[model samples]
Structure formats: C-alpha cells, structure tokens
Target chain A: MKIGAALCVLLLSVIAVHAAEIATADRKSGFEFMGRDTQAMQTDDTSNPGMLNVLDGGALWERPEGADKKACASCHGDASQRMKGVAARYPAFDATAGQVVDLGQRINLCRRDHQKAPELAYESRDLLALSAFVARQSRGQPIAIADDARSANALMQGRKLFNERMGQLNLSCAICHDDNWGQKLGGTSIPQGHPNGYPLYRLEWQAMGSLQRRLRNCMIGMRAEPFSYGSSEFIALELFLMQRAQGMAMESPAVRP
Target chain B: MPFKVEGDAIQRSLTGQPGDPTEGRRIVISRQTGLCLLCHSGPFPDERFQGTLAPSLAGAGTRWTLGQLRLRLVDGRRLNPDTIMPSYYVLDGVVRVAPSFAAKTILNAAQIEDVVAFLSTLRD
Candidate 1:
C-alpha cells in the first residue's frame, strides 16, 4: 500500500511538469503561444476579400508574374517547409536596413533582390494576397517577437501609440479598450484589445484585413490623422500588439461581430 | 400580481416624453443595440451569470436616489474620475465624441427614465 501511494504521487508530479512544459513550448519556439489546432488561421472562402487574395497569392507563388523566369516556388520549394513559422516573427528589426520590417516589406525586398520582380503597391491586393499565403504557412506557430533592446524600443513606441490621446473624440485606445472593456461605446461592446486573432474578418470592414489596417480604422474612429501606409509607426505598433498577446493563441482569420 | 408603487423613480424628460419601463428592459438586454447586460448586472428577469466586470445594478435604485441615478446614466464619470460607463442621455457638449455620432447619445432621455423605472421595480 505504501509503495503504491508513493508511485501515484510521483506519477502526478511528472504529469504536472509535462503539462507545464507543453504550455511553455511556444515561448521557446520564438512564436507567441497558440492552440494546437491550426484551423484558427482560416479565412472565409467566399465572403472575405482576403480569401480571394489567398487564391491569387497561391497562384502568384506558383506562376512567374515577375520578369525573371524563376517563380517563388522555384526557390522556396513547398511553403510548408521553406516559409514555415516565418510570418509570426515578422516586423522584426533588420540590422541591414536599420529599420523594422514586416512580412510585406520583406516579400517586396525579396522580389526586388532575388526574383527581380517589380515591387507591388503597398496595401494592394497583390501584396495582401502574398502576405496571406505566407502567413497561412505559419498557421499553427505561436507569434514570437524578439525581446532584445531594439524590440523593447519598438514596443515602447507601440504602447505610446495605444495610450496616446487622439482625434476629435478626445479618446485614446486605452479609453475604449482598457478602461471601457465590457462597457458599451456607441452601440457595440468594447472588446478587450487582444491582438491574438488578427488579419480578421470584421463586420464593418466587410472583408478580411491585416491588423495594421484595423489599427488605421481605429485611428479613423478616434478621428486621428492616420499614418500613411507602410509607416514605421504602424510596424512598431504591430510588434507591440503581438507582444501584448504573447500567451494567447493565434486566432488569425477570426470572425468578428 | 402587479401593484403601483408611489413615485418609485422619476427623471427629467429631455424630449418631454414619458418612457415605458417595459420597452427600456428590452433595449438594455438587446445584444445589438444597447447591450447593457453585457457589462452590467441587474434584476433582469432572464439573464444569469451577469458579467463580473462592473457592479451589479440589481438593487441600484435602493442605493441611489432617482435624481442621482439620472445624473449617472447621463454621465457617470463626472461623479467618478475613472468610470467606464458611457453617457446615455446628455449630448456631446457635455462629453464630446466623434462628429458622425454628434447628434446621438447611447440612450435618449425617455429611454434613460424607462431603464431607471425598471431598475426601481427590483425590490429583492
């Protein structure tokens, strides 16, 4: 009886440790924590314009749209391996450029440098589609941003963006999201501003969009002058939001009311 | 059985229109329009497990006088420095928001009274 009891206690301890290790695995992987299931990354097939871009992006990856004979597939191989877990770590500071770069900027960079393709317009359908395709490859990976000095500075700037008072509304993101969560602002329930699920399908937007676009919408809501597309401020904000949503699982392509 | 309670609660009518408490109940609970139940707990007949984010309004009428509640619904943060409550009645001159909703407040004056009336009915 004594031996059996001792064995049971030992087994329980082992199980507890194993559970904790699994929970923390994503932190080690350089991705934010995420659910085991990858389906959360799926966009609406018919309704979302982003989904349409996915089809176009997949084709773009395979087809040679550039002047060069080499397609993205020619070099990258199956995206499942070549591009796996790439998107979650983007908006990373590049030492070479001395600036933070998002997946979109990097894709454009690759096009210019390696593929010799003309750069796609910012926030254009081609860009959105390509981003969607690449982001899809990292469906189940946790979103992980580096936490070094550079990332810390970027996060600070992002937090300022979040807390800053702006626009004709005399409102800040903190007022609506932090102070007024669960409360009604206008007609809608102010949801906690978790960036866990992004590139989401918002009802008002009536399409799928990146978190940066959503941030722009929030600026419009506050009546603040929105930054131009592909701004450093936007990228820094993205890094901050992803870090805030650190432990939360990726709910990319989530449907919002 | 329903019994009339004397001056249970009263509020100033913005549009000089008396409000129906029953209609007010429907609006507060409705998910799309008012959605007050999402954050607040009251003597809502059907709702259970009220959200834990804010204080329950189950017996708010007993705690605050009708006039006090009226000011709160109009704009509560004026009383509390860090209130999350949105002003439901008073216009943007009191609390400015965006211009698109300039002519709008969450609830009209009538609706505020109606909600207050419904709140007063909760004795237990």
Candidate 2:
C-alpha cells in the first residue's frame, strides 16, 4: 500500500512538472518581435507614404479646438521643445491622480485644464496624431520609465495580465506571440507586440493608431475584458511594453499589416 | 513555377477552369509564398523540416471530406473558434475596422481550392 502511494506521488509530481514546463514556455519574450531581430531590412524609410499623417498631425496641433479658444499650440509652443523626451516618460505615474496615465490622458488633461476642450474619445485620429507628434519628439531616445514603488506594482499587475490566460481560446498573448512567434499561426506569422513603430499604418487596419489601441484590440481578440481607455491596466501594459522595447528606438506614426 | 500549375487550374476551376495537382504540390512546398510546409506536414517525405503546430496534411484527405477541409481553409477558427489558425479565403464575415485585412489572405480562393485538390490527389 505504501509503495502504491509513493508511486502515485511520483506520477503526480511528474505531471505537475510537465504542466509547469509548458506554462513557462508559453510566456512572451521581449526580443522575439523586434523587426531587426526577424529580418534586417529598412523598416523605417523616409520615403514611406505614412509620413504624411505626421505632417497633418502637426497642422492639427496648431488648430484651435476648445471653448477656451485654445489649441495644443496655445500653451506648449513648438512641442519639439516642451515635449522633448515626453514619449519616453509617458505611461508614467501621476501623483495627484495616484495612478499611471497614458499620453492620450495627459493630452486630454491639458486640453481640459488649459484649452477648455472636452476630451476626445480613445483611439480618435486627432488624439492619435497629437500623441504621434509628441512621441516623435522622443525619436531615438530609449524608453526610460521609473521603477518606483507605484510603477513596480503596476508592472507586476501587467505581467500577471500578460501571463494569465483569459480568452475563450484558452490561449494567452504569450502563447502565440511569445512562444510561437517565429512560427506560423494560421497563414500569417505572428509579430511581437512591440510598440517601437506605433501610430503605425497596419495593412490590416489601413490607418495610423496608438499602441494602447493595439493592446485593446489584442484583448478583444483574446476575448478578455478590454481595459477602459487610459485605464490603469492599459497604462500598466504600456509601461511593460515600453520596458520591453527599452533599448529600441520609437517609431511613431508607423505603418503596419 | 510547376506548383503554380495546380494553383492556376484550381483557381480557374473555382472560376471554372482546370487545375493540376502535381504543379500545385510544387508551389505549396516552395519557400517564397506558399510556405505551407512551414506549418503543416505533407507527403513530401524527403522534406525534413515539418512544423510542430498542426497535424500533417499528408493523409488529411483520407480523414476529412473536401467540405470539411474547405471550411478549415476558409476560417479554421469558425469551426474551432479557439483555433489560432487565420482564415485563408472565405470572405463575408470578417472584422471590418482599423486595418482592412480582407484582401491580404495568404491563399486566395483559387489557391486554397488548388491546395485542396492537391491534397485529394495525395491518397497513397
């Protein structure tokens, strides 16, 4: 009887070990999605047609939008200066709000406080262009989010969210994107969810948008409850993504698909 | 080039033309575009690198009817919605939003039809 019990315990332990191994293998790796890592090609060419949107975004930046008769240009003249390194600093901790905020929320707050304009909806083009222009300021700068107590706590939550499998497919983003990245899923190859060249023109979306919008889309694809626009979960995930692409340069107003 | 024969014929057949399986097999196995072998195993026994994700298509025809196979190609996720497999052909029901990916199917309707024809001929 004791022998049988011992064998049962051994078998259970083996199964547990096997399951853990699979789970560990399913997590996403930070480097697997880099364009340079996949194939050395000119991912960001100046001649690409997508650059036109950035120019349009620049125009919109100076256009007045609020009841206060103000524009983004009203307070921060030439974002090229005031917003330098702003993108790298985003998905940052907000002390008064006591939470993390995305670039969009910050813009909205600025619009409300200074320009007296109502907030734009999440994923709106004006917001996208404005954020893209702002992110452009930090071009080539490595993302530098602080790892203070608040951010550390946020990152841990984001990691749990990334690792946890919540979709109807019973697959985490880590499973295909992280584990099976180089491999094919369906007919298409799964690219890493890096934000290096965001506000990108994805052939799939056929438009320019933010990394937070992409994250929301992924959550929907996974059948999970997508975080509200500029939610802490979204900000935390953005922070995690920025850290993942820490050394990679920003590719705002990027093209995709 | 030879693989394209089956693909061309199958496309023609779907649009009402002739397709050759031998040529179709050649194209499906090639590296450039129809790298089907990267994800599925087939009768190309000499081809050593078989992907680990899905079951081999070598005798897939023997197990599943053509209609079932067609559905898998159309959108494997529909029958098994949890499937990571992307739909190769079927139109109509697709996510129509930000990025319009409707036209970028790896296999057009004709290509999928030709591949299916090639699979049918693999009953050895």
Candidate 3:
C-alpha cells in the first residue's frame, strides 16, 4: 500500500511537469484560431486582400527614389534571393543606433543611409507595402530571433511590458493571452496574440496594417495611451513578441478576423 | 457627492435618487456604455454572444446586498487588487489614459447607480 501511494504521487508529479511544459512551449499560430473562410483567404494568394499591398510593395522595391536614385532593388537585388529568412531575425539590436529596430524601422534606416531618402510615415501605404514586400520573402520560414547580448536589456523590458497591467482595464497581455487564451471574449475566441502574421489583413480594420497598428488598437481598447510609432517601447515589445513566437512559421501578409 | 465605504460595501448611492432598473439594463448590455458583456455573461437570453471571463451575473443579486454590489460596480479593485474588471467609477491612480478618455470614469454616478439597480435584479 505504501509503494502504491508513492507511485501515484510520482505519476501526478510527471503529469504536472508535462502540463507546465505545454503551457510554456506549445506555440499556436493565430491562424489556427481563425475561421475556415478567413483561413481560405490567407492561403489563397490571389484572394488575399493583403496580397494587394504585397504587389504594391513589389513595385516600390524596384522603383528608384531619393537623391542617389537608389531603389531597394539596387542594393539588395532580387528580394526573393537576398531577403529570404531576413524577417525571421528582426527587432534586432542595432549597435549603430544603440537600440533595437523592427523590420519596418530597418527599412527606413536603409532608405535614409543608402537611398538618401526621407523616412516613410508610419502605417502609410508605402511603408506597409515595402515591409510587406520584404516580409513576404520570409513566409514559411521559422521565426529565429537571435540571442544577442546587445539586445538583452531590450528583451527584458519587452517581457516586463508584456506582463505589466496597463490602462483603466488593468489587464496585462499575459492575463488574456498567457492565462485565458482559447476562452471567448464576447463573440470572439481570444487568440494567443502571436506576432507571426503581422503586416497582415484584419477584418476588423478592413485594411492591411503593421504590428504597431494592431498594438495601438489594443491599447486604445484597453483605454491606455498607445506608444507612438517608431518608439523604443514599441520596438522592445516587438522584440519580446518575436522571441515568444520563435520557431513558429512565418506567415506575413496573413489574414485575421 | 461623497460616499462612504463600510467594510466590503458602500452604504450610500452616488446619486441622491434611485436609478431606473430599465436604463441600468440598457447600460449593462450596451457596447458603448457599460461594456459589461465584453467580460461578463448574464441572464439576457436575447444577447447571442456574452463573455466567459468573469463569473456569470445570474445569481449576483442573491450573492450580495445592494451596498456590496455598489462597491463592486464602483471599483472591484478595492476588494481584489489583481482583478481584470475596470474600476468603472474611479479616476485616480490610472496611468497613461488615452487623450479622449482622460479624466473620465467608465461610468458616471447616475450610470453606476443604474447599473447597480439592474444588477440587483439578477436573481438565481
């Protein structure tokens, strides 16, 4: 009887360990939580409204601009070849800038440094198009944000922001996403808030948008003041989200409800 | 108007007069006003979709007294600091409020009274 009781306790502990592992390690794309129609829209390139932005982005990539008359294509050549797997490692620490930068900000840096052009406005058609164009090359690749010592502080800050309660709602991202995901909020099932399919189409917005736009919307919904575009806080949060989404398949220009 | 918090309950209504239960019901279900259904499910049969976050409001009236209900509606955090429910009538200690929502509570004094009146009608 004593041996049997010990065995039962051992089995229970094993089960508890397994549950904890699943909670921390199991990653589900927002795609899984979406409906069949939305899934179909995401899968079919021709049908996906986000593809329109991608197409426009493709055009923007080859068109020369700025004082130096340099298009992104001039330096990078074909995006399919040069930019593949690039988006997977972004929100990276840039030593020159002494800060972390997401893919959109990196593109702006390139335009300023190489193209000698003005920075594109946040959420502008041109910026979204360019980002979508670059990110499309990384579709189907696994997210693999690098572990750099330079970005350690930013990553820590990101993690803090994700767990911190904000606004009048006093709810953290972890409260809904980490704790209560798969539960319904009003009519909609709460998604895990993955960052994989960013620069994607959201039916609620009825337009293609960047991750910053979505973050801002959630803050507004929570009655919190949103961080400005290109803010360090937003970049840090992106770094944390990308790290959290590491190894999830990249699905840029994807669709969401 | 000043009110008093006695233990887990508020002994006085924010508004001097009693609120209409019908108006309270409307505010409770409204997407714009109360936003209660966003994180709470209730006994409304006609509402197709309700939240599954907080406890159901079906037995709320039977669960607590009117004063207790009033305190919760005003600010649940006074009891549970880590609650996800917004402090509908609190304007202090909130940070980074959006420009449009700055210096405003989720519900006004009369609105709080109305919501309390409506919630008080919820019996198991």
Candidate 4:
C-alpha cells in the first residue's frame, strides 16, 4: 500500500509537469507556405527584401537623435552583443509600468525617455527598420517569455482574443493557425501565424513591417475593426502569441509572401 | 444581420428566382461582397489564391439543390453549428461580432440568390 501511494504521487507530479509546458502550434512554420523563389528570397541575404530594413536600422542605431542628442549606440554599443537574445524575451512584464509591453513598445519607451525623442510612428519605415534590426539580432534563438503570476491576466486575455471568434467573417486566430494550419486557404497555406518573423519583409507589402501590422491586416481580412497600433489589446495579443510560439526559433528579418 | 433559424429546410427564395450567373460569378470573387474565395475554391481556375477550407464548388450544382445552397449561404450554422464557414446572410447567433459589422449581413437577399444561381451553373 505504501509503494502504490508513492508511485501514484510520482505519476501525478509527472502529469503536472507535462501540463505546465506549452507546445508550438505545429511542426511547420509559415516559411513552408512560400514557393521556391520566395524561399530563395529568405536564404539569400542579397535577395531578402527584409535586408533593406535591417541595413536601414543599423544606421539608425548609430545616429544620434532628439533633445538629449543621444544615439542608441552611445548607451548600448555593439547591438550584436548588448541586444542579443533581447527580442526572444519581449512582451515581458514591465513591473515599473505594471503591464506587458512588446518589443516595439520597449523601443518607443527608450526613445521617449533616453533620447527625449517623440515616439516612432507605428508601422513607419524607420520604426520597422529599428524593429527588424533589433529582432534579427535574436534570430535562431528560441522564444521564451516569462510565465509568472504577474503575466497571468495578460496572457489569458491574449488567449481569449486568439480563440474567440468575431467580425463579419466570424473567425478567430485559432481557426486558421491552430485548427486548420497547413490547410489551403485562398490558395495560400494557412501559416501557424507565429511572430518569429515579424518586422520581416513581405512580397505583398514590398516593405518591412511589424507583427502588429500583420495582425491589423488579418483583422481587416476578417472584416473586423482593428484596434489602433500600441493599444493594450495588441500588446495582450502579442503576449499570447509569444507564449503560443514558445521554443520556436526566432526568424526576424524574415521574408514572407 | 436579420436571420431566422428554423428546424425545417429554410427557403428564403424560390428555386427559379431570377439571378444572373455572370453577376454572381463576379460577386463570389469580389473581396468586398462575396469573399467566398477566402475559404472556397470554385470553378474559377484562372483566379489566383483560391481558398480550400470548404468543399470545392467545381460541381456544386450536381451536389446540392438550389434551396440547399441558399440555406447554406444564408445560415450555415443552422445546418452545422460547428461549421467554420460563416453565415453570409444571417447575422444573429454570433457573439463578439464587431459593432460596426453587427446587424449587417455579408450578402443581401438578392446577392444570395445571385450566388445560388452562379453555383447552380457549376455543373461539370
């Protein structure tokens, strides 16, 4: 009887441990949706349209700005080292602000506080470049945002936004990314919709853009009213996506169709 | 979106309702109105990027009656609540729907009839 009780406790602990971990939506990434030419666009640095933004961002990092006349390099010299693994852990809890902020928000905060510069307009070219530059530094690193009590509410809200159906189309993020991933939708493979490649270039956009931009486009496609950029809703949704895509390698500055 | 769900086969229009197949075809592909191509690949072989979530409409005329097609377009949930396909005409029974989009059907009565007409002509 003692042995059986001990074994039962061990098995229950094992189950609990397994339940605690989150899994990637699927094995395939959105990269699988591209054709050979598009794949070539990502693998070949010269051909990768996203490189344009990254290059532009590298310049921005060194250039001084605002009333404080401070450059990003002035404080965090050599982003390759100072900013390494930064993007992977974003949408992190900002205890000071008592809310979650994604990478974009973090950059904006830096600009506002240190540089004394106005916030970069969302989806602007300069913003996209900076975001791409920052995110690319973390490429190949697996995403692992903090999962703690403070983040519980934000994460749950994000999950609700993802799973809850809405709009004239009456669709949710899960319907495509989770329920029917890899299935064809509009002659295009429904991607897992991971944020690994945001601030990535797209053939359709012909320019670099952030994950929030992509999310807004999806909302329009669903025939729903999209929230403005920097809204708490977008932040919450980004937090959830980061969690959903945990362990997936970051692919910033990625090219997409 | 004004919609009524009845246990019996819902027929909002007659089988032989006057509908233009050409107009219906244009509507199905239009991003604003039909938007059907978002989840359904039809006989539009030339059109790029057709969706494949739902059944292909290659031979839809032979697969379903005009009444059946209209019902599906009007209120797909009534037939199958679990269907991911949106109800093009019916607006009620959906929660968390956008306020601006609320009380508005994706397609009007005539448009639904027109789509039914176009789909009927999809005989292989």
Candidate 5:
C-alpha cells in the first residue's frame, strides 16, 4: 500500500511536467474561442468574406504574368492537387535563399526565381489573395513544421523572442498568451497565440491579413518597435510558431474578432 | 531632480504637491493615459470593462502604505523582477520605444502621485 501511494505521487508529478510543456489534449485553436456567428462565417465558404480573396487568388493563378509569361497553373497545374497540405510544412528553411521563409515569402520567391517576375509588396492585395487561396487548400490538414538541423537555430531564436520582454510595457508573448489565456482582458478573452490561421480575415482590420501583420500589431500594442516586413526575425518567429503549433489543424482564412 | 527611494518606498511626493484623488481616479480609468483598467480591476462603477490580469485595486490602501504604493507606481520591477506591470515612472533600460514615447515614461510624476492618491482612498 505504501509503495502504491508513492507510485501514484510520482505519476502525478510526471503528468504535471507534461502539461507544462503544452499537452496535445490541452491544445485549443483560436477558432474555439470565437462566437457562434463568427464560427459559422468561417464554416461556410459563401458567407465567409475571406473566400473573396481566395476567389481572386484563383483568378490570379490562371492569369499569365512576368517575363516568362507564365501563370502559377502553368507550372503547378492545379492548386487543389499541387498545393494541398503545402501550407502545413511551411516557415521552412529555404536552401536557395539560405534562410527560413513563410508561405507568403515562398510565393514571392517562386515568382522571382521561376516566373522571372518582380516580388509583390508585403500586405498587398494580390499577395494576400494568392496566399489565402493556397492556404484554403489545407484548411483541415494538421501543421507539420520540419525540425531538421538546418532550422534548429532559427527555431531557438524564435523561442527566445517569444519569451523575451520587449517595449515600454515590458511584456513577453508568453506572459499574456501562455499564462493568461481564456481570461478576460478588458471584455475580450485572451487567446493562446497560435499561428494556424494566417492570411485570415480580422474583424478589426475589416480585410484579409497575414501572420506578420498580426505580429506587428501586437508589438505596437506592447509599444515596441515592430520588425520590418519580410525580415529574417519575423521568419524565424514564424518558424518557431509553426513548430509550437505542430499537429494542430490549419485554419487559414479563419475569422477572428 | 530624481526621487529618492528608501527601502521599498518613496518617502517624498513626486511632484512635491498633494495629489487630488479625483484627478487620480480619472487617470487610473482612462484608456488613453493610465491604461490601468487594461490589466487591473478597480472600484469604478460606471466603467463597463475592467481587466482580469492582475490584483484588484479595491482596498489597495488597506494592503500597503502610501510610500509603498508610490514605489510600485514608479517601478514595481524593483520589487518583483518578473512582474508584467510597467514601470510607470521609469525610462532607462527600456528597449525599442516608439518615436513618440522614446524619452517619456508611461505616466508623469504628477500623474503617478494622482494615481497613488486615488489608490490610497480605496481603504475598506
């Protein structure tokens, strides 16, 4: 009986440690925190405003452009087949660029390298549209960020940045999202900072936006200088977020209040 | 002139003038200025929203002396290094401050005194 009690305490301690590391069972998507109306908007394609960007992106995929006069479909055939589950493995290390790149950057890289076209400006309508369209293909797929040696350093930096105190507020991402998630902060419930939803529509912005834009908004709210768009720091952070959110289902083009 | 800290408290008033509790309450509840309600709930009945991130401001006077409250407003980090509360009257050691807020503290000395005064009134 004494040994059984000791073993029970030991098992409880182990469970506590695992929970501290973010147990898979405890993971909840930002979608779970939304109201019924917003959830409905994300569910139906016709009612979702983000579908408009996906539609525009579908059109852009067939239209030819650049010096090569090639559309994305010319090389990849159909996005439904070629792009499915593609977003799940993104924020990966790019060998040619010799660094990590997110889905948006990957699209620009393809335009520059394969189609011989100029890169689209960050946060532009066409870029967001194309990204939203591609991400829509992987709506139900789980995130699977690769954890090879090539991306190990970037991943470490991302983890560090997430915990580091910044801005005049001196708040880290972990302080609010990790410690105080589900708690009310001035009438809104704080959410676990997940990256599964990107190129999604925000009610606050009233338009489609990328993960980078959202990160910048948080940094400004913290009163910290935001890292420039397309900076390696942002990519590294994205890489870290994707890895942290590993195995969670993708909800790109998601709706958030 | 720099304010002096003795132990965990500031003995002297920051602006060397008695703070009006009425003005202090205004600053504590204002979103554009103090932002206290963003992370703290206080005794403001008219305010529809209050934060749940920190201790309630109700009965703060019963909890600590006025000098201690003053130190907390000035720089709570001096007491607790891991606190999420901003050092309202501190400027040095902060990084990447936006251009408009570069050299400024979150609250002025007068405002800090006002908040302290308002907080002191919550004894109950």
Candidate 6:
C-alpha cells in the first residue's frame, strides 16, 4: 500500500509538470483576440448570437422525452440550481468507462440513462442548445477540469496532441494559440484558442457550436481529417483545453467571428 | 544545383544567383505559396498583424548564412526534430499528407530560391 501510494504521487507530479508547461504567454483567452465590434457582440446577451442556442436549450431542458416521458427538469428541477458549476467539471475522468469523457459524452450519458431519449447527433441543434444552456449556468464560474489520477494520462495525451505538428500546413495548435496569440493569422487575430467561450456562435460558421465542433474546425483548417465526434482524441483534447483554461470565467454562449 | 540533399540536411549556394527577390517577396506574402507570414513576421512594415510564433524574419538575411536559410526552408526538422515548421522542400516519408499535396514539395526549387532571396534581403 505504501509503494502504491508512492507511485500515485509520482504519477500526479508528472501530470502537474505537464499541466504547468503551458507557455506563460498563452494565458489569454480567445475572446481577447476578437475585434472591438465582435467583443461588443459577445458581451450583450441580446446581440450575442450564441444566446439563441442557449435559449433553445432552456426550452429543451423542460420538454418531455422517451419511454419514461421525463424531462431533465423532472428530477433536477431548475438547472440554475442543480446544474450550476456542472459544466466546469466536465471532460473529467469517467471511472466506469475507464477514460476521460467530455461534456458532450456526459450529456449523452444522462440522455440515455435519465431522459431515455435517443442520443442527439453530433453538433445537432438539440445537442448544441442543451450544452449551451447547461454551460450558461456556470457563467462567470472559474473552469476547473479534473486533475485526479484518473485524468492525468488523458491530460498528458491531450497536451502532446496540442503541441505536435500535423496537417498539410504543418502547424500545431500551439503555433497559433500559444506562440502567436496576439498576432494575426490571415485576416483574423490569432487567439490563445482556449475552450472557455464554446457553444459559441461564430460569424464564419453563422451558427452556434460546441467546443468539439470548434476543434473539428481547426482540424479541417490544418488540412487534417477530423476525428469522429466524441472520439478519444477529441475528448482528450477537450480535457486538456479545459485544464488549460482552468481559471478563466465561463462564456458558454459567446459570440465569435 | 538548385539544392543538394545531404545527410539529414540540404546545402546550397550563397551567390548562386538563381531566384528573383521581387518574385520571392511576392510569394512570401502569398497564402498559397511561401506562407511565410502564417508563422513568421517578415520585413513588411505596411503589412500588419505579422505572426509572432516563429522568430521575426526582419533581420533574417543578416542573421544566418544563405546555406542556413536554405536548409531551414528545405527541411527544418533536421535542425529541430520537434519544430512546428514544415519541411518546405522535402517530398516523402511524411504521414497524413493531403492527397493533392502528396509527393510534392511545398515550394518548388525556384520558389525556394526566391524565398531565400527574399529572406536574405531582410538585412535591416
């Protein structure tokens, strides 16, 4: 038991080292890179396009579903009460699955077990809406991705993927997000690419999107084929991103260009 | 020779007189060709929002010999295995390369020379 405890300490220290290795210069949020007008759009709930998705999620939260005919509200009551701070803890280690599960996966799990509803399609309207709504409950809450023993390995893996160069462009996420965040890439100001403002509405996409969808967009932009939605790579990457943005305020329904 | 491949590196001429600086500068800013601006800020004062990821190319010509610049453009992995910079002139042994881009160097020989020429001109 002593040796086991020592090994656990050793492993956690390793993860701590890796987690702390994020460049100091990469501390800015993606929101910091937005133009003035774009920044203004995200600040106002009415002007922010992402609020549309969040409002849709509010409607979905109470709607009935499945063989049990129960909505998410049936057992939980008001999400603002029960679901607060929930989004901030996700992409956490799921012991039963023996791997990291992102917020999207966790939501689907609840949908299956509680709502008895069919899983929403990846990036589907209902999924985006629901995620946006739940994440909105945690607005202004500091992000705190899981860092326990169960999550250490996935966090390291995600960190490696973020730094490793891939795609026809031969750029890693770090090149733009970490090294040159305040600079410009093409016409847009390059951001630190944190996951804080996800379930965001993008002007380029002209729609609300989850963090996974944004990851897929970067993958496509790098000219690499995107992994399947909810794939381990995406989950691990999401875990790393959340941990990377560990202390930033949540901005789930943010608007972006 | 436009360039000669060495063990894990490439060597070329300083005074080869092959590439055009005017053409090279144009390609450096072009998104499809040199893509120098994507990761590097060059000597363009009027061009705003230059990248800060890689080192600025403002004094590149004075910073290194033509041979060093050529080696980097040809295959930067030789200098740093983990460098995010692409091997612009290497055409094989890469994984997950796009189908349209497979077996093709990112920049042609002339374009490489052009980029080198442009980079060398950043003496100030």
Q: lDDT of all predictions, in order shown?
A: 0.64, 0.63, 0.87, 0.81, 0.88, 0.79
Please give the fraction of native interface contacts (Cα pairs under 8 Å between A and B) kept by each candidate: 0.05, 0.05, 0.59, 0.60, 0.59, 0.31
What tens digits encode model 4's per-residue C-alpha lDDT throughout B66-118?
77787888876655555678888767766645677778888887788888889
| Top candidate, metric DockQ | 5
lDDT of 1: 0.64
lDDT of candidate 1 over B1-124, digit per residue (tens): 1112223222455445655778877877775555576567766657653554467777776887766666677665445434445656654433334455555666666677777666656555
lDDT (10s digit) by residue, model 5, range B11-100: 899989878899999999998899999899988889988999999999999998889999999998666555678999988778877777
- What tens-digit string does per-residue lDDT give for candidate 4 at A1-257? 85775566567556533432224454556787889898888978898888888899999999999999999999999999988889999898887667888888888888998999999988888888898899989988898897778888989999989887778888888878876777788777888788888888887888788888899899877878887798988898999988888888888888898
**Ten consecutive residues with minimal summed lDDT in candidate 5 chain A?**
A13-22
**Which wins on TM-score, candidate 2 or candidate 6?**
6
Ranking by DockQ: 5, 3, 6, 4, 1, 2
Which window of ten consecutive residues has the lowest lDDT sum in model 3 chain A? Answer: A15-24
lDDT of 6: 0.79
True contacts kept of 2: 0.05
List where candidate 3 sits over 4 angstroms from the true fold.
Answer: A1-24
Is candidate 2 or 4 superior in DockQ?
4
TM-score of each: 0.62, 0.60, 0.91, 0.86, 0.93, 0.82
Query: Looking at candidate 1, what is the lDDT of residue A165?
Result: 63
| C-alpha lDDT of residue B2 in model 2 | 13
Per-candidate total of colliding backbone pairs: 6, 19, 0, 6, 0, 0
For candidate 6, the TM-score of chain A alone relative to the native chain A: 0.88
Instruction: Kindly indicate the candidate among 3 and 6 with the higher lDDT.
Output: 3
Task: Write one digit per residue (lDDT tens) for candidate 2, span A90-193.
Answer: 77777766777878888888888788888888888777777778877776676677667777888887776666565333346665555556665444557666
> Looking at candidate 4, what is the lDDT of residue A34?
80
